[model samples]
Target chain A: MSAVGGAAVPAVDERVTRVNPLRRAFTRPEMGAVAGAVAVWVFFAIVAGGNGFLTLRGTASYLEVAAELGILAVPVALLMIGGEFDLSIGSVIGAGSMTTALLAAQFGWNIWPALFVSLAVALALGAFNGTLVLRTGLPSFIVTLGTLFMVRGATIAITRITTGRTQVGNLDEVAGYDVARTLFASSIPVGPAALPISVVWWLALVGLGSWLLLRTRFGNWIFGVGGNTASARNVGVPVGTVKVILFMLTAAAAWLVATIQAVNFGGADVLRGSDREFFAIIAAVIGGNLLTGGYGSVVGAAFGALIVGMIQQGVVYAGIDADWVQFFLGAMLLIAVLVNRAIRSRAMGGRG
Target chain B: MSATVSSRVAAPAPPELAGTTPLLEVRDVSKSFGSVIALKDISMSVHAGEVMCLLGDNGAGKSTLIKILSGVHPASEGEYLVEGKPVRFGSPRDALDHGIATVYQDLAMIPLMSIARNFFLGSEPTRGVGPFRRFDLETADRTTRDEMAKMGILLRDTDQPVGTLSGGERQCVAIARAVYFGAKVLILDEPTAALGVKEAGVVLRYIAQARARGLGVIFITHNVHHAYPIGDRFTLLNRGRSYGTFAKDDVTREEVVTMMAGGEELEELGHELEEFARADGLAAGRLGEVGRELEAEARG
Candidate 1:
């Protein structure tokens, strides 16, 4: 429809027909993730029927597991789309939980102050990861990987050195413990099911993350920097600052999850959230996020966490071996990426 | 502003154009990287509502000169003037603050983003305040479509990703975006170099459109045919130095091509190559094949 070739150009109005709303929706990057979630849910419902896996109580169990991972997965998805990775989030959780435990139990501090210290430690870990990556121009994958082991070691060593055991206990006896538990660990009752408070937190975080990703200038800059860093610089985007802020957001989510778990259990296991970093990344990949970055959705990552949660609990309910969950998740990641690429290609007129 | 542009070839430079100062003027500008001098003693001026074509052979420091003008690199020596006043640019943003915009060959656009999004990449239109501020998609789409139409680029869907557009269309979008953003002096880096015949024609028409809109345009190209039609003034660069600047009324298209191709030196090299081929038995047949291909290209 260029004026240079106006001879056979179709009428402008004819070319301007409204695109089908449903087709447009289907073309979104998250569609594959959504469809996969539905498929897995249906499959689990059929396989685990009469075994209580589809029951309200069973649903709450899976949702609780999903909520813990979803809180981390949403920000992880954002980080991935911004072209970086934070492998230290799992260790940040352990670090946060241990900080809360040591400060409250060993140091005789109030639980509220202890929680603040834990949050501060988590933020520091995130800032360290972000600054190192930006300043040294090293890959975040390598930088956060180093911090991952360092934080894990520090959490274990500090806990064992102060407390008699690797685990810190007796958190419930601390002052203001009841308020902390009420805010983070308490569950809400509905009919025959008890929904964990983390689920509500997860939903809130998802809403906020989605809003930040889709509705703001920062979101546009995230996509721009991730897609083409040189071009983003040419256009005057503060790429490093956007990346640092995203890293902090991921760390904050980790602290939230750790707070929820430590309060609910009234203790800290030095090895808490072990290997969950890989799980969070898997969830992001399954949510249709590219490992190479520049494309993804917060909603898709949430669905990916749901899939993981279902498979994690559904395997036990169906009497299947628990070890198969890892294999299924690994396979799901590959399948979702392929499915997303195919849909993207078709929607983008075969540019995939 | 529109008074300076006329559809006829070799139209006299407008009275206001001659009366007012040039928007951008460079005097004896030179750039060097380490021991190598990329550009030397290059001087040029671009007036508003004028298309100044920069003609050069490969490795003739055309890119270096454009970079200096667009603020990607500072001139190693000499003065850069804007609006009859001297100015030093620290970055592209500094130049942009003075209403100077550069459309690089890469376009600095994200292909995965929509046209409206890329149109307003760093300077997005937003409403609300603080955390509540949001990208104004409605206004963006409307402005993008409206501005492109003004440049005679009628994209049916402004929401479409820029990757799906043809090369010519993308150039037009870049031009339209620059104009809409209040660019007084626009620099395009080899806009037609990678395009097809029809596509290049489309880009040329938009350059004319930008000229008609009264923006001072610096169109960088090595192709004389592309430069001659719309160029009011031509500055030929060879071996890191300016050969001369010529108005359209002063130079012929063939003369520009001959000078750009290094004139008699190129003919001497061709003759030497032909002689070398004839002097060797094995090279004669291979050179004949190359000669045939070159002849075919010329015929096409």
Candidate 2:
């Protein structure tokens, strides 16, 4: 290829062949997640025999849970790849649901306007977290952890003050509720099963996020900043902008999941998304994203969410104690991390 | 002695290229941070198709000069010029806009990124429009391979992480990246300090190659041997001021080495060592015998 834009003279080195295709395949970061997802699916299918655990109905059940978790996991993966964390994502979801509920049910606003205001608030909080991190030069983990408590407390206090309760309901009676519910929370029928609309949203987000991380300039900036912030800035990568935008993206995803749940159930409780941020992070880690940052795949994170979702319901189908879900999830997380580390080393051509 | 040294240090320019304007010139520029002056009245000029060797020990204002030239810091006094036109740069990006790129000693490349990705880090080539616009991966991979090959660095795969590359290869990649981005003046900081003998040779060859490609190169280093082979002009700095710039034709490698070492300082150090040894020789102990032997070896 000739140099584009008269940039540089192209040289004459034409040795373009993969040294070992098999090795390359095993080295990909997503391989571990793909394997983990398959393993969980099979294990559940075998233990829950005759329970239709492998059927379309059973698949939909797990997929719905996976879809909700996946929605947040994909963006959280991106944020981690950009070398930041958002502990505030779970709180953002609760706040979003509360904002929509408070606005539509208490303030008597239209559902559409209330939804918009909720998403805007989520975006603003994300920006606040980003700005605080950047301006203070503090770790995002600490900043977002602080936002987590602040948003959670505010959500609880506001709901209690206005509605005299920790929960808001009767959202279906609000204006434009029908349209919002149909668009965001309605399910579609498949052969032998009905699927949640959130599942479709999750898959769409996964595809979009994967394309973004693998194919875009902004994606490169995300990797660059995470890998080496000083080097990235020296090359004029606009590290601060990329990071803030990632923070906002995670918040937006949380808001979307919150809207789907609020519309689907017709109400929201204050504790709707408690401890879910850790689940999202677990999925991302299982997906091969380094906790240290700079490396990951959104597709891998989707599979990670699927594994969590499978175990969440699979334990029940297999007649195991419900509390075993946490135990299994913790074990899966550990295995995924170790397996991902191995794949990463192999991807670096097996260097330490 | 001064007159003899001046005559010996007079550089002769090739007749055809004598009158061209330098690509970058710092005219008596001075920089100070608070009460501390980092550099003062330092003047140097680099022409296209020539490598300007900036030689200095640590804390000798080399970094300050580089920062000023690359627009990381503005000169506290005097003029910084590009193509004979005086300019003040607000940021490194502004300096880059004027075609001056600084390849720092740290290389400014993300080690975890792929070769193609690192090659096109800031100014990525994109195809399509709007949301469909993506990093032109095929082009990026191809161009990265080809440009690196042009610098005599042939990688097995452009998709390989840059961290896997050797130090020499990494430096070459940084140089090639700067050149690909249309850097008219490429300033490299200590490009060979951390390299082996063979790797140092490789970097020196590329410095000369960059000059041959019509780019003005400022190769900063403390190693005289590394600089002596590739540099067209040598400017030595001591305590934040230039001794003087001398063309390759006018200065001997021996003179450059002695100047770099500071002859009087070496003599003073030798005398101090002798006095220390003599004072220790008067001590009547086993430790005194070891000191005498070291002193004898020094004298010998």
Candidate 3:
């Protein structure tokens, strides 16, 4: 009544709430993912500890892989929670890396300028994907599927036309390469471990994402739009904008990941991020985001990535067959989803 | 309030409408989809603190009329007035802006979202300003608690998902939410249709509570028993046309039910059903029995 915010006002003093705090904590979507990550680490520490899997160096090696994938997974997870798929991210990565390399290496542009242009291209592609889905009323799965092929095809065709090769090189000679590399590809000394700077980007993005979904109004609209789009529209939620923004964020993340890879290697490949879209979605699912949308956590996606990172590195440390990596990823995803389903049902089953 | 109709049965603007103007009114409204007419020549009024029941069978133009009122669709021919002024709403938000909120049968609440979140939905309250602004969860939870309590529901927790609530409880939540958002006129579409007897009773009580808070309610339903008690006036719609708007004082329950069923039409339908029964041997026993009953009821 005092705020003039609207007709609805909370007294802010009626606190006879009835939910148990402990039960509430257990129902977090990411709880299973965090537990699974720990479990995987524990398994590897016992089996491959002597192989330096428990060492600081080994941790850094796995985390480096996790961080890059996490950057993409986190945004993909947010988009998934909004009840849409962005399959074009893998292609966006390829397109972005090619753009970065073509400008910096072939055109002799500064790395920063190349990266900015690359980012612009990615965002435009994202907006295009979002707009097509909105206008056509097609499932983003189908729409982005078309974009995935179209973007990949365009990137490859352009690369061939420009250089007559799938790979581009000589980016190390570009201006601003040193600063760009320091920010994106360089390592931070942590005790004995020189952890990749991408880890920092990954963690920061996760934190920012957590804040957005939990604390921000846009986060509510994301859930509203995904949960029941027609209902959200009925109540005046701008459903189209929320979905489009999510699509753009995923594309931006793809650009970040692709830029990091290209700068680190001083080159780019037309097929750089071929299957990373599935990897990001896998991490998201393992992190506790529902495929149906309306419920998820970015922190969960981080743990999901951690689980993935451990498995990718742990197989080599433990001297297991590399062929088992895909199998483990699939198994982990299935197990995490089962756990999420249980948690979801429990959370929804209110006391009468 | 169960007497027969005296007069003023089919008047567009009845002479008895007194003092304050109705919160929402429609005059000679008609809606047509392509070549088919869904509703024609329908007129209704809902004054403050009144429950005006729109009673009709399935396919009786009830949904069409509700859609027009809620601004989902415009009537091909009609004048829609809110607060005594002619208004054309481009969308449901425009209707809500004019203080006309419609609680659809679906309830429009996200089942996976907590009751607090569902209560606010698109109209989330935020704290602070600009990029730092945030969805104030504490405020939403508290408001949901207060509003649900006002509707006589002691929720176990506002954090509980709405999908877990019973049908009646969900209806109450939807209605309570509409009221909390300052809806001057509430359009409830078949709210009690999917509910159990006890759940229906709970929803009916909440509808009464909403009316008690001086909100005009348009309770649309096919059930005569549900509407006859709480509804201040009855508008019977049949075959895309209104039989008449009757005050409860001028109509008994039996008379209302008979007219709503169309006694003369029932006699004709019964004869047709008997013919079908003779032609089809498999369902003849059951179909013949139903047809005989229809004939008896119509004749009586």
lDDT of 1 by residue, A1-352 (tens): 1222232233465645556767777777788889998998888899996799989999999999999999999999999998999999999999999899899977899999999989988988888898899999999999999999999999898788877688988998999999999899999997699999999999998898888887788888887877777667666677888888889999999999999999999989989989889999988888878777777889989999999999899888888999898888888888988998887775565664
> What are the candidates' individual DockQ scores?
0.31, 0.42, 0.41
Error (Å) of candidate 2 at residue B282 is: 16
Residues B1-300, model 1: lDDT tens digits = 112112223323444567688899899998999999999898888999899999998999998998899887899999999999999998777888788888887855677777887888878889998879998877887788778777777766776778878778888888888888899999988999889989999999988988888899999999888899989988888889987777887767876776676655555555555566778867486774565544333322
TM-score of each: 0.89, 0.90, 0.91
Q: Model 2 chain A — which ten-residue stretch has the worst lDDT?
A: A1-10
Better of 1 and 3 by DockQ: 3
Q: In what order do the candidates fall by lDDT, top score first?
A: 3, 2, 1
| Native contact fraction, candidates in order | 0.41, 0.56, 0.61
Chain A (alone) TM-scores for all candidate structures: 0.94, 0.94, 0.94
Count of backbone collisions in candidate 3? 0
Candidate 3 residue B176 Cα shift, in angstroms, is 1.1
Best candidate (score: TM-score): 3
- Runs of candidate 3 with Cα error greater than 4 angstroms are A1-21, A350-352, B1-8, B11-16, B268-300
lDDT by residue (B1-300, candidate 2, tens digit) is: 234445654343434457988899888899999999899899888889988899988888899999999887889999888998999998778888899988887755677789899999888899999979999988998888789878777666777788777788888899999999999999999999889999999988888888989999999998988999898889988889887888887777866766666644554555565566677675535544554554443332
